[model samples]
Target: MSTDGRSASDSTTASALESASFVRLVTKADGDGLAASGLVARALAARGTPFQVTVGRTVATRTERAQATTGGDGDLTLVVGSTDATNATRLDTDDRPATLAAVDHVRDLGETPDLVLALAGLVAAGVEPGAGESEWLIETARERGLVERRPGVAIPTADPVDGLAHSTRVSAPWSGDVDATHETLSDAIGADLEAETDRADDADASGTTLEHTDHRALGSVVALDAVSAEAATAAAAESIQRVLKPYATPDAPFETVGGYADVLEATAQTEPGTGAALAMGHDAREPALAVWREYGRRAHNALEAASTGRYDGLFVVGIDDGPVEAVAALSTAFRSPEPLVLAVGAGEAALATREGTLPPLEGVARDLESVLEGTGDATDQGVTYDVTASGRRGYLQYDPAVDETTIIETVREYQ
Candidate 1:
């Protein structure tokens, strides 16, 4: 079924699948990086390849170091989002050494990989193929005749739902059950291809549920309990790989965080009681408490309204801490039948609420404005307010309900 001219049971498929590994990098937290990661992951998943993905600066730095010392072990490394690839070791121009010292190191131990698939952006930005410190890499690949270039291929890089749908159509496994599942998901969420696609490629902008879902699904598979704009993209992609594995005919081993919608829905169904509150905090001292108070007020009102028996009796639990602690409190509080919980703060609040850290108040207002006005680009202005000498006390006031645009615009102007 593949170019290797071997049956599925033959070692060819297994070898191809096993010999591949992935390393992802993003130039920034923009739509392009998200789309690229989604597309590449989909391709690898369809081919039954094993991979590991990492994003952000710290992860990227570690990945580069590992690859340089690992030697060329039949692995296909995909680096995404290399805005400035000057310091990259695997790429070279002329006088540079291109040797991936890590790959080379691993090769000496008899673990040579078959291919190295560097994302195009990274390739374009890295040390121009054999100039400065990259000469070693270019020359080595040339000597081994292993530098094969494949161009003009545009993979369908979109959100998880779109990418998965495309992959299902192209790969050998197509089923009515899968189609029905997709249709059900789309209809349940009122999602159309064009709209979902737009949300997926929505630049650095933010969106509501629909927009957030598409964006999140593109990056990773996520469990319903873990819902945050930051984590959704990655979670969705991860989920697709997991759901598809059981049907892979050969029964490939796959894992993914389950969906979170069910959890939210289930929590909403519980009777209102002394539940916990989840809040958001930015500066941790002044604004964090203010935000928590607002969240508490809103959550309490929502819960109370729902408790009227016209809807499910969900309670609100309030948490005042950093994002991490907030998420933890949310997780802990949700286990009981608390009436309401408000999580506030940065790290603690994020943990308690189970929603990633709340964006800065100004950023949140800007994002909300973008959603309401149907514009994708909203300027983010750093908040500046008078604070005590201890930096532990300050006053921040922005009405989320009134003149949201003006407030954000003012912040931007001052910034």
Candidate 2:
């Protein structure tokens, strides 16, 4: 149950979905959103219910579109990937990941157990599988085909070459460099690459069945190399454990469920339309894969090129190119004990805490507004802001004259 004492069971959501003449699944374009949409689609299909799925940027936009289409009639609308809902049923699991709740929704609707969907939800959720509800979910997925009981080194694919080449957790020199990745893997694990690739190829040729033992052992070795390739901070160890066990489905485009989620996230960051299509079960793999690979390459380059400086309890990074949002997260994942402040271009900055222990940005924004006399944009994790002599439209407006260092120091003072 949630801390609010709300039941996690999908009985109510299932009943609502079953009785509605038509359903609309509104989700974000991210990995979790896509996974949630797919799960809902499956459940509705099993129930023989008609539904339409759409992707949006925020809860308001998603529900607004749903309402516009449904005309505020009898159609039921469900919001996924976010806790906030308006005139719709929210399918998020304790604000963790919507996919978990979606999995339960499918079963509640009497759909048969789907191993791939369950495994994907677990991977996307990125929570410990030993926990109460997660434990039950993982056990069911394992009974069907899940290989590992817990998360290991998160190299998304069974093929070490492909996985390492696309890994952003590790820095350059090996990331996006297939030869370097291969050499690193060969030196670290000393495995027979030819034989292993042959086996993986055979598995792909015959079917999508994963070689459980081989994947487990190989994933460990690759994970070790990934840690060594980057600074071996405590955050590196924590990030290493973020990888879910690799599982595959013949119906999906990627080899492992981890790979599927990875690519989806990458595509979401780069080519959102393709990402949404792939999430909604559209046939756009080739273009999506291209975008995912390029996104990985650019993200690695950005991380490598970022200039890092230290404050008392903050590590600030400045990125001149590439995806600032994604790099901010990557920097946080590899951060030290100090919180990370990402300086995006010259106008705005974002702050992130290790493991997201930072309190809501609302209070911070309020304090900053009083002190700096500027506007601030707050999110659950961090804030986007710039100090203006006079607040523009009561919102923080970027002033290029105000340097990033000033913003970082102001944010730190409030923290």
Residue 29 accuracy (lDDT) in model 2: 51
- The stretch of ten residues in a row with the least summed lDDT in candidate 2 is 386-395
TM-score top scorer: 2
How do the residues 192-267 of candidate 1 rate in per-residue lDDT, one tens digit apiece?
5344343333331111223334433422222332233232323233323322221110110101101111111111
TM-score of each: 0.20, 0.74
Q: In order, what is each prediction's RMSD in angstroms?
A: 21.5, 7.0
In the range 246-282, model 2's lDDT, one tens digit per residue, is: 4444354666666666776676546767876666566
- Candidate 1 Cα misplacement greater than 4 A, ranges: 1-34, 57-74, 83-415
| Model 2 clashing-pair count | 1
List runs of model 2 lying over 4 Å from the truth: 1-12, 59-72, 83-85, 146-153, 169-173, 186-221, 244-253, 282-285, 335-352, 362-414
Q: How accurate locally is residue 288 in candidate 2, as Cα lDDT from 0 to 100?
A: 71
lDDT of each: 0.27, 0.57
Residue-level lDDT for 171 in candidate 2: 42
